[model samples]
Target chain A: MPSLNHYLLVAGLLFAIGLTGVVLRRNIIVVFMCLELMLSAANLTLIAFSRFYPGANGLPDIHGQMLVFFVVTVAAAEVAVGLAIIVALYRTRQTIYTDELTTLKG
Target chain B: MPLPIFWLFTVIMLFGAAAVVLLRNPVASAMSMVASFVGLAGLFVGMNAYFAGIIQILVYAGAIMVLFIFIIMLLDLNTDKKRTPKMAPILGGLGIVIAFTIQLIGVISTTPDKAMPALDLPASAASFTPGTQIAKNLSANSLPDVHLIGQSLFTEYNLPLQILGVLLLVATIGVVTLSKKQSN
Candidate 1:
């Protein structure tokens, strides 16, 4: 049985890597991809915690998994809208680079 | 008594995440994300969150990534790959790693043993009468899996579930309005 520390560390490392990608990547789509990575890390942690703490008498406490379900649903909706927005922006601006899409900057 | 499968999936996940950062093409990065998601799902399954693991594959790797790749193709964006930036962004990325390293250390040292607030567990409420059909069904649970999720989702979280439905509907309309080619 891998200790809680192991799972937590892996999830944390994954989140850090995703964060680094988000900060450094200029391509908007890759940044969004990295964002998904971060979300996945959070989901992993939720399931991990849920598994470890099963409440009284060894019954599984599934609240964290419950939260993960909603998170996944929200993520799906968010990605759909976000990709649509990105595609529309690409149509209008001919570029998906975040630095170049500064027409609204004042 | 460690699980080899957990470590295996963790290693794969880290490798995929690194590829997501290092790959030049956005399509490649998105594919790496799918690999990472699958690895995470494997971990979830190992942890016995079976429904979550399957949903991670279906909703995340399946639907969301297809949306990403479709958008990438629609925009013809795979052709304009650029080298990863050198100085400023790298420094920024390094800063992020350092900051979250501290957080990891903190979380590893701390214990989260408190009883998280309960969310109207079926046994706690008075609404369901013991002899009533609803109460009998609600009280019955073989295991923590999809059926349990369905019961809790419809009963305890019914309002939020309805709200989520509304949110998805709104998102669909918004995407159509936002991305639809301008009507002539």
Candidate 2:
């Protein structure tokens, strides 16, 4: 049987990969992919914990699953708006490179 | 055997994730992300949360990813230029070191206690009233009886749900306002 630690290690590695992406990637869409990777990592950790610690009623405390649902919902909303913003930026600037988007610099 | 299966899925997920980051084309990256999500759903099923795993496939691989691909197609981004990271190698190396150090500390701190008793499931196999007509009615549907989830959502977390609804409404309005084209 796989232990909770194994899941945690998986989550940790995923998070690290996401962090590397966020650091190395310049495209906004790829950055969003990294963000999703990070969120999924957290979700995996939560579900593992929920499975390991059943609630008083003996049900796999559905809180973690519920939380994952909400996270997915929010991620949808975020990407919808985020992609729109990126599109608008691309329209105005003609490029999606982060370094080139320096109009906000004081 | 299960360990090998799990390891295979894990390797797939990790490889897909790396492809998502490294692929030159944005569309290919999005597709790899869908592959990763599918691999993740498989892992979830391996963990015995079949419902969540299926939902992960339906919602993530099916809906959210489609939205991503649709936007990518709609935009039809040009690959005119190659972009590189802004940070120096020294800073990037420092960040990696910090991330690995945190992971190392987390792994060390959470040592499993063999003596600590494994978590127990409730003795009553079925929490609901057993084998009644009502029970039969409840279990007949294909949907994971979300009644328990609904009850918890409405009763205990009603306020949060309401807040989330309002937030979604606001975001919808914002998107509409932002995306509308202005007449010259």
Candidate 3:
């Protein structure tokens, strides 16, 4: 029975690692994946809070879980649009490296 | 309350996250993200968020990861050869250590669930619900979580549910138009 603190700690670590991945990775797709990882970390924290932090009446709070729903939906929507953009970029440039995509001027 | 199970999933999740950062190939990174999501989903179930846990696996591990794999395969990406050496690990390790220490301090000093003062207000005090039979039943917590979620979404959060539907529609159209091949 790991406590709420343990869950929060893991979620924090996940967020930190995801942030590092975003900063360090050059590939656009990999960076996108890291962003998704960060979103998952946030979702974990929300779920943990929803479970452990009961309402003052002592019933489980479902608000945080509901928010997780919205977050997951947004993450799905982001993946769809993001992957499409990545594919479009690959078609035009034949590369997915973020470093090579220096200019918007064409 | 199985501590060993909790430890097991946490290790898998952290390992997958590290692999995502370290792997050279985008495909491998995507696969590792799947592993991490699965572990997180398991934890969600352990915490009694059965609906969210299921959705995490279905939507994230299933749909999102498949989409990533599809794009990676479609691109036929060359090996990401120009790896940034050592800096990510060093900086990432430092950031993780600092964050862990801070969180541990909070965990040990204060009681768990004490940080969210906003949630501590009685539901009756809020306009959401007074201390009624329904709230009492909920306090007992015997109702299935999915059912409660469904009931709330329709009654209390209907407007937001509609908004989410619209957002999904927009995302679908945006993806299609963005990816379409322009005609010569």
Candidate 4:
């Protein structure tokens, strides 16, 4: 059977890949995708831990799964607002390149 | 049997993640990310967390991915198409080395010797009906009920849940204001 270590390793790899994307990509949308990737990596770790550890009752600790629920809810709200902002920025500036959209830079 | 399935899903997830990063087309990347979410859901199922697995598919693969694709389609991003230039081979090598080092550290920190009791016990010890013979006869790896989650969410974490609702409401208002043609 695959152990918890295997899942943690996969999560770490996902996080690293996501980090690479964030660092290397210039597109605002791609960067957001990378951010989602990072969140998913954290969710994987939480789920793995939940599986390995049971709560005080005989049930698997619902805490990790519950947290993932909240994370998903927040992520959805974030994307909704973020995409709206991105769309508005695109409408105003006609560009999605992160490097080019530096109007607020000091 | 379970191990092989787990390996298969893991490979699928890794491949999908690679596609998400490496694909030039934003739409393709979003689609690949959806595939990764599906693979993750499969992994959850393998761990016997059926509710979470189903929710993963529904929320991430179904909803969030659609939102990503919608944004990709809405943006019409053809003007900015110059691909990022390839980095020097030495830099790429260094990146790999750093990734490996981090992975090694994670492995060391989460070693089996340091495993906590919270995660090592049988599921039965944590169930509500631990004394029942019927509960004992039941499979040790059954998924928790969705209704139970709802109950716990409302009862135990009600305050945080209410706060999240408020946050969502604020986000919705902000999005509306931002997307509007003119401020009222």
Candidate 5:
């Protein structure tokens, strides 16, 4: 079995990749996907902690999984709103590249 | 979990994530995200989070990816692929990634809880309510993940669950309003 540290390391690497993409990617949609990657990385870490640390009943911690459930729900809603906003932005601006979205820059 | 399975899924997840970053087409990125989420779901299952794993696949790999692909197709986007990479952002991003990785490695290496719990440790049968399904499952050396999660969500986390429902409602309304054509 892989140790907790191994799981944490993988999660951290995944998070790092997501962060890099968010910074370097020009496409707004790809950036959003990277954001999802980061969120999933967080979920992995949570699940790993929950698994390695047994609860009072000697089972895996239930709260972490519960939180993951809430996170999934929220992420779904976030993606819906975010994609809608992206579509709206594309409709008005005719571009999805972050470099071209300079109207808000002062 | 077996070492090989762990490494396999990790590779799949990371490869898909990298593809999401390097692939120029948005559709390919979305598909790669699905593969990544599927790998994550497998990891969740390996950790004994059956319900979470199943829903991860259903909600993320299935519904979420489909939504992303739909939006991409709807937009008819053929984004510019020729933009020269700016040095500043590239360097800054790499700096952040490297710094974060080093910090994570330092912290994880120093943490005391390096060892995982015994894989076959049974859930204490006495802790659960007698005659309940949870107790029954515990006695059988298996976790009733969905039952316990449902109970916790309805009881201990009831308020937050309600709030989450409201938040989802607000998001739905927001998306509708945002997507609607503006009247001048």
Candidate 6:
């Protein structure tokens, strides 16, 4: 059986990878995808913990699963809104590269 | 979960995540994300979260990835040209990631007892009342994972569920308004 720590390690590494992508990648869409990666990593950790710690009924806690459900719903909505924003940004700016989007630079 | 299967899914997920970052083409990156999510769903299943695993595939891999690919195709995005990243940001990002990884390892190591205990399934859980009907499916040998989740969602987390529904509705409206053409 894989230890709880082992799953945590994987989740941590995955999160680190997502963070790296968010920081290093220049394309806006790729960056958004990386953000989703981070969220999934979080979900992984949550499910692992849920399985590791049994609930009062002597089964895996459903609370953590419930949280993951909420996270998924929110992520779906976020992706929809985010993609729409990206489309609108492309329409007005005709560009999606992060470096060129300098309107907010002070 | 078996040891080998755990490692297998881990490798699949991590490799796909790396590809999502390294691939220059938007469509390829999106596809990599789908692979990563599928691997993640496999991991969820290994952890005995059948419902979570199902939704992970259905929501993340299916719906969200489709949206990403559709946007990429609609935009007709060009593959990123071969260009070296600036040394400063590259080093900085790597430094942060490495530091975070080390910190996480330190925390995990300090907790010497981290192995998960064997699953403990009772003959009957209080959450699974007779009224639910699906409660009949629950046995000592089998976990009614879906039934339990549904019961909790309707009872304990009902308020939050309603709130999420409202949030989704608002997000839908927002997307429609945001995507509409500005006639100015």
Model-by-model lDDT, in order?
0.81, 0.72, 0.81, 0.77, 0.90, 0.89
Instruction: Tell me, by DockQ, which candidate is best.
Output: 6
Interface RMSD of each: 4.7, 3.2, 4.5, 3.6, 1.3, 1.2
Judge the docking of candidate 4 as incorrect, acceptable, medium or high.
medium
Q: Residue B76 in candidate 2 has what lDDT?
A: 75
Q: Rank the candidates by TM-score, best first.
A: 5, 6, 1, 4, 2, 3
- The CAPRI class of candidate 5 is medium
Candidate 3 C-alpha error for residue B115, in Å? 13
Across residues B1-184, which tens digit of lDDT does each residue of candidate 2 receive? 1678878878888888888877878888888888888878777777656666877788778887887777777777645365554559538755884778586567646787221124333232355676744344345532232555666678887888888898788878877877787466
TM-score of chain A as modeled in candidate 5 = 0.98
> Candidate 4, which segments miss by more than 4 Å at Cα?
A104-106, B78-80, B84-106, B113-142
Using TM-score as the measure, the top candidate is: 5
Each candidate structure's TM-score, on Cα atoms with residue i matched to residue i, is 0.86, 0.84, 0.83, 0.85, 0.96, 0.95
**Native contact share for candidate 3:** 0.55
Report fnat, model 6.
0.85
Give the Å error, residue A60, model 5. Answer: 0.7
Candidate 3's DockQ: 0.51
What residue runs in model 2 are displaced by over 4 Å at the alpha carbon? B78-80, B83-94, B105-110, B113-122, B131-147
Task: Write down the worst ten-residue block by lDDT for model 5 chain A.
Answer: A51-60
Ranking by lDDT: 5, 6, 3, 1, 4, 2
**Model 3: colliding residue pairs:** none
Put down candidate 4 lDDT per residue, B46-97, tens digits, no spaces: 7656778888888888887888788788887745577567577437745874
Docking class of 6: high
Q: After best superposition, candidate 5 residue A106: deviation in angstroms?
A: 3.0
Clashing residue pair totals per candidate (backbone < 3 A):
2, 0, 0, 12, 0, 0
Give the residue spans of candidate 5 off by over 4 A.
B119-123
- Writing each residue's lDDT as its tens digit, candidate 1 over B1-184 gives 2478878898889999999998888788889888988899989887767899899999988999898888888888878655555787678678878988897888788965343233334553234356755455445633436755777798888999999999999999999899878877
**What TM-score does candidate 4 get on C-alpha atoms?**
0.85
Provide the lowest-lDDT 10-residue window in model 2 chain B. B113-122
Q: Candidate 6, which segments miss by more than 4 Å at Cα? A: B122-135
